[model samples]
Target: MGFTSAWSISAHEDAFITELVPCLGPLIEAEETEPGARERWERWQTSGVDDDLVHLVTGGGHVQRLYRGLTDDDPFCVMDDVWGQEGVEERLFFSAFSKDWAVRGLFQAVGPARAALLPGWCGNFVLTSAEVRDTLPRIEEALSCGPLEKADADRRSGLDYLPDEESVLDGPLRMWRLAAQARIGLCGVSLVLD
Candidate 1:
């Protein structure tokens, strides 16, 4: 069964510990200089992130606010992925590349093919995590029975039209707005499903 309608995610104190610790692993790593650096670093290097944790970096305060809301309990001391209003995507991409490249470099440093599975913690899962794999059957069941999932899939498919090659590459902020809205919207959907 698949997820059909959005369910409520209780904003509880332990939600971050159970749900978001994996999602914020990268962010926690990027801000290693902050206080409580040691624990945050260790968690980032060890936690396994699932695919349900969609990476959404935004410039507006909304994204940061969302992160803050989720992490308020433990105050995950990480750099807010929101970097002003211009370089959000660039920063996120760079951070991702840095982690992936650093892992490969570590492999090169120690020995060939030794650094299996990126050494540190898992970032975001793709679409094949075991939890998600199991969850999807339930989700499918829900989707088959309800209208929520079908409606969202249809909506997102429509959004696919907005971020094509010509439109996004045509200008800067033009695509930025579209991309931001799409990302935020999708994130909301994911949270609802979760």
Candidate 2:
């Protein structure tokens, strides 16, 4: 596994997300060409009626921190925390999901000092080397489970629909995450620690 340098990125103000739609239009159209693609996307738009998903990702590991703040002030700037917004941190095996938007994230331990500063840090796990090995199969199982097999079930299931290509993989710095894909319009950060 390889480790990449840590960095931060932010969503736009107002929407709390950078509108990558225009840039992502081509990719969305491509997904439309995949098997049952359009139906899957529509289903995703409606899935997750009541559950706030606590997805997990475990691979080597990467430390990525994101925050929601005044886009006007930071304007695409990245920060260390949720920036007064709600978020969570935990140790996890690398994982990704396909519900509202294909999401791939990581889990890492927060230092005593930084944990005090970051929000969304309850009930998260700290990963161990052995735990990492144990978690890989689980992560693979989660990703290989298949696309949203039922209508509206995806929404109710608390995850966006994902195609096989969206599987998370080991990246630089032992980091495992979903490669940037079209269906993943909603973006969030997963922070992991060594």
Candidate 3:
């Protein structure tokens, strides 16, 4: 599995499905849904609605990394090990919850508004833009303190999975890249389950 990201143009997921995903289209030559689709596509292309999302797309696959040596252990918990911050493992989401619910939960669960959500990180959590912004500094601080590999290695022998090579794909670095891109994209990283 991997991850993809975008700028948070909306509290819901409209920009992701409509704006950012379409930016991947080849120069905006809209496709035909049926026999008469091309004409409709062309009309929309020249409709003078400015494509506002082109500039927000970040280059590179930030969350695109193989799960080489990861365990079921929470990465945010690993962050806690480095940052000494508590309750992070609960704050993250990886599932397809309703946008309003997820966004509200994240906002409430991460900051001064956060409460006893009572064991979060259930069913594939996702973070919205505000949540990402709230948690990013802690990530940055944790990265500065130490590598996640160190903390993770203690739990399981993830190092054994490594080949005798130097240029291995680092999970922590990939996380940083994802967070950075999400910050710029005004969105949070969405894990792409394989």
- C-alpha RMSD by candidate, in order: 18.5, 18.0, 19.4
Better by lDDT, candidate 2 or 1: 2
Question: Across residues 134-178, which tens digit of lDDT does each residue of candidate 2 receive?
Answer: 444543433232344322223333433245422222221122122
Candidate-wise lDDT, in order: 0.26, 0.27, 0.27
Alpha carbon lDDT at 60, candidate 3? 23
Q: After superposition on all CA atoms, how large is the RMSD of candidate 1? A: 18.5
Q: What would the TM-scores of all predictions be?
A: 0.20, 0.23, 0.25
lDDT of 2 at 30: 35
Off by over 4 Å in 3: 1-14, 17-123, 141-159, 164-173, 181-194
Location of the lowest summed lDDT over 10 successive residues in candidate 1? 185-194
In model 3, how large is the Cα lDDT of residue 30?
20
TM-score, predicted candidate 3 vs. hidden true structure = 0.25
Model 2, TM vs. native: 0.23
lDDT tens digits, residue span 152-181, model 1:
433432222223322111121232233333
